[model samples]
Target: MGALKFKFLFAFVLVFIVAIGSANIAEFDEVWQQRAAMAEKDAEAAYDPYPEQSRNRAVEGRNSTRRSLRGYKGACVATNPIDRCWRCRRDWARNRKRLADCVLGFGRKTTGGKYGRYYVVTDPSDNDMLNPKPGTLRHAVIQPEPLWIIFKGPMVIKLNEELIMTSHKTIDGRGAQVHITGGAGFTLQFVSNIIIHGIYIHDIQQGSGGLIRDSVDHYGFRTMSDGDGISLFGATNVWLDHLSMRNCHDGLIDAIQGSTAITISNCHFTKHNEVMLFGASDSYPKDSIMQITVAFNHFGQGLVQRMPRCRYGFVHVVNNDYTHWLMYAIGGSQHPTIISQGNRFIAPHNLFAKEVTKRDYAPMSVWKNWLWRSENDLMMNGAFFVKSGDPKRMAEFTAKDVITAKPGSYVPRLTRFSGALHCTINKPC
Candidate 1:
């Protein structure tokens, strides 16, 4: 009887232990299933249907946050305002404000508003007039008429003809578009404080021997012809903004003959021999100290070689994006003191395969020009193609210093207009 009681007690204890273990296992399985279901629900919530207003609000919140971090104002942010509205104007205002603070801090040094007088040129809307007279130098002034001559409509001016510019006058564009056709070019001789804005200039072929074509097949380097989209001569305090030029023999923009305090911004240059030409003849020693700023521009496509040639001067090439080029995206002069910063150069293959050999004339100084190679870009050309005496400094460039834009990308705010004071003209011709 004692042995039977002990066996029964042992069996009862073993059964009780198994029951407790089974209950614990069942509880763990239930908890795990609950957690999995909660995770799935959260994922589903991520795709919840929201109204357009809510979506916009979320985006605006994100943009606001980013703007706050960068100390930037999103006042001019819009979608494609150039066609319907003056978007570039708005951006120009914002940029001017940002630069004004910096310029004031630098003590507002007076750089002789040599191109001071401003003028407006237009064609006659009526058939009564054909050959419109160019404005005179004496009439161009900062006071009274303020050198604002309104051209009637889009027309072409003949070459070798003089358009005398007086001091402190800026040639502001009317709402109407102006096109300068034929092989003629405007010569700005001894002008100061001039601003040419919102113009489309094309097809002004340079005179004989003005452009040289290379046998090589580079995009921007090989020039079939020579005529700059715009040329500046002996001009100071000049601003060339919101302009587009394509398919010229020489350069899209050319600055020669001692042009100083020049700013070329928010412009597009495509399908040209050279995107920009700084110095043709450094005959004038003062031209050697060319102080120009080329910024916020898009240059690409159909360009074969030598995007820019900077000879004998100080230049700040910043915040411009180059899509594709054949060779030597930018070539510097043997002269030093050139700052090439905040620019993006994109070439998948050996875009700049032909290295520029250092000329014996002078020691060229090139620092911080960014070069990019895409995964799809293969180097079929030889590796040692680039010929620069100072190749050691070239390897130090990184993506952080370059301003690169993706292909087919554009910033609409770049061309928007923000504020303008409209003044009425009482006297008419």
Candidate 2:
């Protein structure tokens, strides 16, 4: 046999072996089929948050409301149509639940407080974390059944401990100034179907975690928390929107330990060391099934690292305006699949941290097969993304057909309303 023919045969055998390995890898196209199976089992659940006529229009079942937010009560034309969809109406404060219809992303399946009656919070106190008082934020969060919680007035609450939230709840802060600050923050653990919107959460301190009330009927001992603005542990189907968060002791948001079907949209995060973290660690195999959508947010001002550091999951970061960063931006480990689409990243003037990506806990020799990709991303002012992953496998991602993200230049328009919004009555917000 010719030497060239022998080399060709050897290459073919190597390709076959690697193809088999791709079948078992966590950060690849195979996980899309896994998510589809989960969706099939929960088919009875309805996407009824949207009007029947406008269901499942685009990627991630997003049916965007293309309503123009201009010309209502002399309101200026808005850039983000999603933020304008509900608040543009004259009767916004009256029909507050309509904000549920405005959500557009992967966690859009969340129907939080959709089936519950409204509960108004008149008190601003968090006197006790273990024994909550009625009419307080703590009391509302500890309720067992579904609730649409709203604030009656402007108030700043300093929590004594973690505000442990129950399942099937919505803490909607429309028409009021609500701030959860100066102390420990939220702990969302082992729950599902929750929505947190239009609030300011910042300046968090770590908790000496002990017995905390999660629900009216359930109170359990908790270990010390890491002081994240929002900590999601083993949670699913959660949505966070229109929040202004900064200066937390740990990450601004940490979704770990099998948290799936989550979305973080239109939130402003600033002045933090570690920013967002997805999946817990590479050792947790269950986290391989996690999937999250992060879209239409602003990673602005005083961020050190980890725009999101992932481990064993599929995370889509799309259409975000990143105006500042002290260190590198996106990162991953444990072969997590990251699809960065249409984000504007402006690196700090520092030369050492100009790269926008980092792969932790793995060397290139072993991590090259991980499926990390960047599409239509705008890196400006010397910013760059060091991409790694299987290019062929990334192209085959099934979620690509469900939701097509806009380009990075559109980040400015998408993240126009990137924090807690104060919508004036009879005015488009």
Candidate 3:
């Protein structure tokens, strides 16, 4: 009789577990569909049909000699629409808050600290992890109120531990040369509306875990960091722009565990393997909501692979200059939708690594149906992109071609000022 009871209980528990699993799968599917729709909408909204037409018309009116005499410095040259929005202004310092309104792509809604007062970082020291000084960058980011953080001068801050950030903050390193190196990197975990711009983040090391203040009201024990230059764990509405990154212990930038609505733009990356990873785990179906836009960045020398590698997400890689790569440029697994539009891919001299895209843990029969498209991409040095999926599906994913881009041949001119700019007080950035 006892044996019979045990068998009946086992059957009941199995049914209950199956029911819960089915319900969770249904929830995951629902969230994925919603986020995918939102991503498509954001991508479409960020498109500009003709950014260079006006400039080209003006150049045509002027003679070559006159144009040459004008020079590159006198003219405020803004290539892409994102740069044109703010980089053309001479009084950018006077109106520093205007940059908060200029974010494009999936992170367009990120108005980081736009409504808040400026918090200038006068100190570059990170002596205290739990109780940071008032004039330090750590203090500026952990405040409960919004703040537009900026540096007073050129400085290098080697953090003693992982610098945790709060919501509604902007670290604008426009006028000053700011470098965060030889230590741990920034951590944006479960935060939103953050903009990290114009900072050099490289040579990072893993942090030994201890008590760290993450916010104004929260101080908690933490674990050792992965040593990424910028690590995003469950973060949203974040934009990283005009930064130079390389030679980190782990990835240059990593967004994982349900992080979404991010844009990495106008940055320069070099001398790094596993440059960027969008989704970390294949089993994390919650990452289906992850969406990112990589635009106008220069992938320079001594790079290996994953610029970036994605999984279970939508990534729009548009108008970037890939000058060098030892391994494959872009890679993925678990059926991520990657739209490569008008990007310049110059493969290395190595004949074995000529393919721009790499797929893992999937056979041709399965991965051939994944939505990966290359539209107007310029491939050089015998480089090629192995595209898959149906044309109709590609059209649908692109929202009827609302997200248009310039041809990849224009990449050099578009990405001319890719990295952090040296802006004078009253000059255009």
Worst 10 residues of 1 by lDDT: 57-66
For residues 1-429, what per-residue lDDT tens digits would candidate 3 score against the true structure? 999999999998667655433112212234334533554454344333332232211100111111111135657788777787799788999899888877777776788889899999999999888889999998899998889999999999998888888778999999899999999999887677899998899899988867777777656656577789999877788999999999999999999877877889989998999999999888887777787889889999889999999999888898888889998999999999899988889989999999999999999999999989999898889999999988676545433212356778877777777777877788777
Off-target runs (Cα >4 Å) in candidate 3 are 1-74, 398-403
Clashes of 3: 0
Candidate 2 global TM-score = 0.82
lDDT (10s digit) by residue, model 2, range 79-169: 5545766756778777777877666656877878878989999999887766798999999987888999999888898988888887789
Question: Candidate 2, which segments miss by more than 4 Å at Cα?
Answer: 1-78, 398-402
Residue-level lDDT tens digits of model 1 in 347-383: 5365345442122244234332322112111122332
lDDT of all the models against the reference?
0.41, 0.75, 0.80
lDDT at 112, model 2: 84
Q: How close is candidate 3 to the true structure, as a TM-score?
A: 0.83
Candidate order by decreasing lDDT: 3, 2, 1
Best prediction by TM-score: 3
Better of 1 and 3 by lDDT: 3
